[model samples]
Target: MIKVSEALAIVAENSSNMPVQRIPVRKALGYILAETLYSPIDMPPFRQSAMDGYAFIHSEKHQYDVISTSQAGDHSNIKLNENEAVRIFTGAFVPKNADTVVMQEHVLANKDSILIAAMPPQFSNIRNKGEQIAKEEVVFEANTLITPAAIGFLACLGITEITVYKKPKVAILVTGNELVKPGKKLPKGKIYESNSVMLEAALQTIGINKTKVYKVKDNLKATKKALKGILEKYDVVLISGGISVGDYDFVKDALLANGVEELFYKINQKPGKPMFFGSKKDTLVFALPGNPASSLTNFYIYVYPAIKNRMGFSDIHLPKLVRKLNDPITNTTGKTLFLKALYDETNVTILDGQASSMLNTFAIANSLLIVPDDVEGLKKGQLVTLLPIN
Candidate 1:
């Protein structure tokens, strides 16, 4: 068996980065930047008003007269003189020779002349040219995820389109003869299928909205047929269950029979030790354990990062938190264990009765408490590393 980190490295090394494509600014949200975006023009290209106020020479004190009103998008080439003031709204361009802006509330206005009650400090209420951004400077770097704030920033820099990595198409295969579709009454030992829905939801959260799901029986012929059909259509293939050494586990055998080379199998980790990876042609396949918690945990720890990196994201790991364990938890000194935990601002508590097939506990978990394989157990209030799950 290979170490978890080493197995993860193999997956990362084999995955290919997505190609770059030009997309409209409206559709670029959640996509990763393929190239650095430089500002073609300075943000706020000209000096503008930061508030609704009067722009005038500060030294002229009470000798200022109202000349004209300036709203947003005013292009009048009017310049200010000593004792002359312009009524400027927020985001309007500041006129020349206006050194300060006195708020409207502070100015006593008459028909012709305005009496200044309080003089604002120099450069007050003014947004200077290039103050937010400079011309020809990098506004966003490559590999940065395009979020709402990033989109707004790019628009502020006058960018109408951007280059981003193409989103990967994922195909999910859930194999089991005893599994029945939802809404159907289970017969004897059969249970309703849930892995397909869970995996699809997980993929959608990371912006990979394009997905196809295939339900295959545990028979070798049926499983092999479905796997071959999906490999031709999707960029990445995720198969849940049927990878272990049991008689019904035929995923590894089918892949090898179809000319798919096994990259690695069996990581040294609990709840997901039966995970395996293989590749045929350009399609990458991950065989996750059948148990819901184990499958999801392996997907987060191994597969999700590979997909993110292939999509051109620089940061592939989830955010981690240092928290104190609220209960004592014991584990064997072999495989690393990721315990489902509930963590908030005040406390982090590990959930009791953890089984790989259970789903109720995972739904309420906010973080995963990582227990090293070398440690036998942890006492209450012990500091531990927690990885947040979205």
Candidate 2:
């Protein structure tokens, strides 16, 4: 078994970025930019009115003759003379000779002229061309995460398409005879399967939607066949259950039989110590514990980062924070503990029902309090490392 840090390092070393694809910018939210992007034209491309007002050449005057009326999206070429003004709406192009704007509410309008209520500053309501971003300026560097704001910004700059690292194709193979699909009648000792659905939603939260699920019995041959088929078609395979040394557990054997080289079999971590990480060529595999809490915890701590790294993200791990503990907690297991907890910005509280099989606490958890193996426990008010989850 390896330490948690060692396991993470191994995952990082094995993960590689996916191939790049040019996709429409509108569909690129949450993807990693594959190439540096520069603005093709200045943002706002032309001088623009920031508000509905009178645009005019600045002069010390109580009134001005209205030359023309302009609304948003209009390209007005009417140049203003001294004391000349245009009735302009927000987003309208500011004529070249205009240097100031006065709110319509502040001006009293007569037939064709308006009286200014007070003097306005020059360039007060004008958004200068290239004020937000200049033409040919670097928009974003490679590996930048495409957020909604980024998409809007790119759209405003007239960028229709962007190159981004393609999301990975993933497969989930649930292995266990005791597990049955949800909504099915419960056979004496069988439990409704949940790891697949839980994993599917978890992957979607990270922007990965290309996934398929397979069910495999505890039989070694069935497990091997299922693993073989999924390994050939997916970039990553998440196998739940059948990884421990129990007589019915056959995932390890199946993986080895199919040429998956074990990089690390387990880690010194609670709830998920039976986890397995291996690779067969470019395909990565993670055989997680059968327990619900354990499976989901391992997915966030290990599998999530691996998938993100493969999608070209440099910051692949969960968002972290150093927050104070709201309550006391002990880790007598001598293994690194991942405790499901709730947290505000200041402090975290470890919740009840932390057993590996019970997911009650995990359902409400917004963060995972990480207790290192070297430490036996922590007291109330002591600061601890936390990994925030959705």
TM-scores of the models, in the order given:
0.96, 0.96
Instruction: State residue 68's C-alpha deviation in candidate 2, in Å.
Output: 1.9
Q: Kindly list the per-residue Cα lDDT of model 1 for residues 204-265, writing each as its tens digit.
A: 87899878888888889988888877887888899999998999999998888777889999
- What C-alpha lDDT values do all the predictions have? 0.87, 0.92
Q: How far in Å is the alpha carbon of 316 misplaced in model 2?
A: 0.9
Judge candidate 1 at residue 20 and give its lDDT: 83
TM-score of 1: 0.96
lDDT at 352 for candidate 2? 92
* Tens-digit lDDT track of model 2 for 1-390: 999999999999999999999999999998999999999999878888888989988878878999799888888579888978999999898888898888888899987999999777877988999999999999999999999999999999889999999888999999887888889899998899999999999999989876899998889998988888899999999999999999999999999999999999989999799999999999999999999999999999999999999999988999888899988888888899999999887888989998999988899999898999989979999999999997
Worst 10 residues of 1 by lDDT: 56-65
